[model samples]
Target: MRLLLLISRLDCLDELDALICNAFRRRGWEVIFGEINAIAADDYRCFTRGLLLPGSGEPCHPGPAALGNRETYFLDECQLVWVMSPPQDYAARDIWQMLWLASKRTAFVNSIEGMMFLDTKHALGYVLPKENRVFAYTSNDFSFLWERYRQASDQWWVAKPANAGCGQNVFLLPPNGPNVRTTLQCLTGNAVVQSLLYNGEVGAFKPEYTILQKFILEVANGEKRVVVVCGEAVAWYGREGNPDDHRSNIAQGGTPKSVELHSGEVKLAESIGLKLMEHGINFVGIDMAYPYIVELNIGYPNGLYNEMLTSGVDRSDRVAELIIASFENHCSLLR
Candidate 1:
């Protein structure tokens, strides 16, 4: 069997991508690397025609005419396509639409429709519980923000971009702070404002804003990152933030350590896995602080290398086996 690894760029290969590639190769499946923009509708037409050469370390660059021709095919030989990049442009969206339509014949690890549901922080309000919900609104007016703040008794608010992740452009809005209007106007424009989930217990403050979320104070100790594959929590690890830093993301200088989850936390992770499966998401990294989920990562979940290094246990082989089994099951259903 063959698998297509769709990524944004061939130049930058992260640890997860490398691990995934190695896993599939070890399983004796041919892995093809290609950019999403190179895919077209015609590529889904035939089973005999291959889009690009199999197991070619070089990137695939099928021409537009070749993509338009029904005789020309790419990815037609592959049984599964693993999307590694999130849609960031119109071209990417177009490719996603083609992939969605093609999913009828080809298996995708996580469908485009599922990714869209978890792409933005605003989407969290729908899936997460009421207490875990972080009210998100896109507007620059201070009056609107003030009205929303008045509705909540919380003393702090956070402003960030609705579409970003990894704690980018996140800021704290304090109650009764001087120059509130200026800060809100500058930060909340074309952004999202959420009630702060954390208190002054953490430490001093930093200013950044592109996406906003309720800062959970429990993350000061560290946050749990649970890797769920095919609706199972296969492995998990803790990410402890730097001193006084509220962001525990590994990208933000957070340290990784092996962790054991309690029954409640395991149940929570299972619940999230079920919800993700409903949307056809089979692999994900869920971030949580005990009772509350901080984020649901759908696009290329991280922490495999760190988890393996810290725990002396690598689940990549298991993940690879599951992916292959899923494909086999899919083929069996067709038969």
Candidate 2:
């Protein structure tokens, strides 16, 4: 029988995660769901340390010491371990490291390192052709970025954190905008001040780098998200920005809508999916504004549920089938 271990933050679990778990369980696969915080590593051994939810039944600690126990398995025992989220901080990083080490014995849907690489906006350079890539620059120095922004020919630009999502801290820089300087300072945390103590020492914190990209006017129309699974585009949808905002992220109040996929967009997504597959990243979300690819999401790339809701076509089952097919192929190669 096939076995799968799904790892995600319990507190962050949503309808999507539940759908995925049900998809696997319906196919007669043994599924174990747990939080990353419950995972522990002792030397080379990695296993969950708390109660885990089974495919169908009450939650129970999966060991001999548990009250209700069926079977026990280490990280290596599962046929596939799907890490649904990327490491966000120190604690998460530790858990991810353990999973990475255990990956030698069991497969992970998207390799931890691959997701981390795609999580950074810098990956756009490697994934998309220059003609279709957004014009952008990243720097931690306020003065350096300011100089480049001033020299740019475009009347409008965007500044955002290099590795943030959900449109947090994203800003539009209008030509000669009065608050440009303050915005840059705030984004980079470059404001300097003297110590309150009598010590009279002046200190300025090291700036956090931000991504500066030419604002594409087409984004005002909307941004499209393409979900690619197993090196193929499976679902597509659009997010329209609200009147007061330029970002089309649903988390930022943008609304999801059904849209026809342009032939060029489909081709672009297929080509990019092949490259991502080579890195062991099986699931991805490609964000686009017409011809230019704005960004990519490799860590729990969403939009499948929305697509199902809007188009009334449930691709989740197809996604599960493709993933299982890929897993079987990998196993055959090893054998």
Top candidate when judged by lDDT against the true structure? 2
Reference-based TM-score, model 1: 0.79
lDDT of 2 by residue, 87-197 (tens): 547677787777788888888888877876777788899888998887888887787788888897357999999888888899999988888877877788663432234
Question: How close is each model in CA RMSD to the real structure?
Answer: 8.9, 4.4
Q: Which candidate achieves the best TM-score against the true structure? A: 2
Q: Looking at candidate 2, what is the lDDT of residue 247?
A: 74
lDDT, model 1: 0.67
Q: lDDT tens digits, residues 1-335, model 1?
A: 77776766555555676677767766767766666656655434522222333343533222211121122335555678888777457676676667777777778888788887675665677667776555466544555765665565256667666667787756666665565455655565422333333343332233333343445566566789998888778889998786665567677778898899998888878887888777888888888887777778888577677788789986888888887887788779889
Lowest lDDT sum, 10 consecutive residues, model 2, at: 59-68
Q: State every prediction's TM-score relative to the real structure.
A: 0.79, 0.89
lDDT of each: 0.67, 0.76
Q: After superposing candidate 2, which stretches have Cα over 4 Å from the reference?
A: 1-7, 49-73, 191-204
Error of 1 at 1 (Å): 0.6
